[model samples]
Target: DGYLATFDLDEYRAVKGGVAKKLYRYTNKRLWKRHRFTIGLRSLAEEKLGFKQGQFESELARSLAAPVAELQRFGIVCVIKQHGRMKQVHIAKKMKRKEAKEPSAPVPSLAKKLLDRGVDNAVELVQRFDAERIRDQIENFDDRTKNGNDVGPGWLRCAVENGYGFRKGFKPSRIVAEEQKVKSEKRRKAVADRAREDAELKTQQAADEEAFAEFLKFRNSLSENRRQELEDEALSKCSEFERNCVVKARRNDEIGMFHQLLWEQYIIPTLAED
Candidate 1:
């Protein structure tokens, strides 16, 4: 019978004094919907029989027949939704049963018997069933890919959410390593580019400093009177042109010195460390 049931783990724990620990227990509603029938049946069994679905023996099923039938007759459905370590079962129909016999205990109640076995049995069953099914689905995934069917993004996302694709194989670690390699390569390239730019600027600065030193040396070698005579002669050779060129050259030297001092005080130490 088609029915929907939502089972909440917290509520289950409050009743049973034990928690659901399977990875699949925390899966979202949409993923659980893939096995909606199984989930609903399990929830109903828990609710009506005070036994987890996996513990639903033939006798337990028989015990719950009346309640199941009543819901079925009323056209009400049960939906089960599981979150991590929690299960919730939503019943759509209201059965006309007396308050006294209306499943007096909470589903999977923490009576002595349930306390002894319920938690361990429920967790084991869920883990075993879910792991086997996930393994089969992964093995068959290649067939879908070969047929040009992309497993929708949602499918992959669900697998990741449920922790199915990794830990089983070394694939997740491999992917992480590859991503790290790419980032490392990008960082190296950026550092190289910056270094090249710094080298070019340094080379230009050194050339300017060397030329200025040579000019100063020549000027110092001459007597003051001889240097003045040479300046007057150069000015006389080309009046406006010489004056303009000399003025501009002096201005450039002043600007270059300012930049050189700034680099030495701030930029050079940082670049050298890198």
Candidate 2:
């Protein structure tokens, strides 16, 4: 892997260090900055970590400046983003806890083998490996099993459960799509229901209009004396229930309103005014 190093001193000393000697392409510092030579892997080992380490590392460097300057080894983790969502997914095992004295959490680091996969924008994580594959490699150890030292998957779980990890929001596209789908379905069902009710109402109205017209024609055809005789005959054939309904509707009500269900098929004639 190509290496460009940095140090804390009167100024800062950043030069080729560690595995940079292994490659002829990395023989000079000039080649290290070139995009072609830079395509190869970089190291994430504490001794070999570069400025390109992610936001998590940057936060760590800022938070634990004292411990780092003391050359105290510590663990670190990073949060990444992919596809417009934040993913606080740990990749490999780093030093674990930021401070030597702190409990070891199940913090995965970007391994030296996967250094090139690291990105400066923690929001855009390198997708070279999936979370499941990386997660499978983590092993959680019990406190006492490792002699009261927090290490492994168990520590990671504890750390995350205690609020050390990142949580992401719903994907914007997915949420919008689902909301639109629900609205469309509701609109479709409402339209269908309204149409059905309108059709039924129109059919009933048409039937009522036809019945009223038929009754008017029948009444017009009969002379007043004949209509009265016919009405008397019909009333005599009616039940006590029908008689009572007619009495209740004696004023300002349609003649058809007093008809029994069985008599409804035939329209009732309206009597001519005296």
Candidate 3:
């Protein structure tokens, strides 16, 4: 395999000077693989640049200033410096200005969809890639899986990870598609089951809250002595560990709060059972 350096040909053509042109070409070839490098001037002049005659290292370095400045205008940054007795050229491409990214507010909805479709660690994936990229992958995955023969969460995850449709000339194999379809169905079912369990838990919590509120009103309406008797009865029904909690609360002067807890945890469930 060989390294590939890509640049705008028009931009390359517009840069002035032989030194600048060769410097641009050299940096472009390497900068794609690495960000920065330092090359000794003698080797750079003789081996890389192919200058007609040998010049003093300092003279060669000074000559590079104009070319380096010209190259800078075309997106490369270069500096000539002395290292002991040798002159070295430090080179790197200028970083492009990044456009402001859209905020991550929309990530949750996109992540949820991916989660339902059987992508594991969906939230992390969404956060890492951002909503726009994930959305693009989703569209690509949907298009690929439209035939519905081998389709599932695995396929979608693979599509997102590999950039199946978006990357040039890359597609998932038939075997991979079939495997993903099978795995995705299982993952989707698991996700749906968890969603159902969560909904049931929330519904139960709401019902419990309503029941507790009703019981609180009834208890408050009782005479003070009757309320004390009801709290004592509930406390007696609690486990030894729960009893210790109440005792600790009482010591901390949070007895009233613990009494309410006793009613909610013990009395409420007993009332519901009856």
TM-score of 1: 0.26
Once model 2 is optimally superposed onto the true structure by TM-score, how far is the C-alpha of residue 236 displaced, in angstroms? 3.8
Clashes per candidate (backbone, < 3 Å): 20, 12, 0
Q: Which stretches of candidate 3 lie over 4 Å from their true place?
A: 1-5, 97-274
Task: List ranges where model 1 is wrong by over 4 Å.
Answer: 1-179, 235-242, 245-274
Off by over 4 Å in 2: 1-172, 248-254, 259-274
Whichever of 1 and 3 has more TM-score, that candidate is 3
**Rank by lDDT, descending?**
3, 1, 2
In candidate 2, what are the lDDT values of residues 152-261, reduced to their tens digit? 33233332222232223222343457799999999999999999999999999999878777766766686878755665566677777876776565454555645433
lDDT of each: 0.43, 0.38, 0.70
lDDT per residue for candidate 1 within 14-125, as digits (tens), equals 2211222221233223333343333444554565334655663454445444544433322234444565554445444333222212133443321222123222232222
Best by TM-score: 3
| Best model number under lDDT | 3
> Model 1's lDDT to the true fold?
0.43
> Candidate 2, residue 214: CA error in Å?
1.0
- Sort order, TM-score high to low: 3, 2, 1
**What local lDDT score does residue 171 receive in model 3, on the 0 to 100 scale?**
40
Cα-based lDDT at residue 175, candidate 3:
38
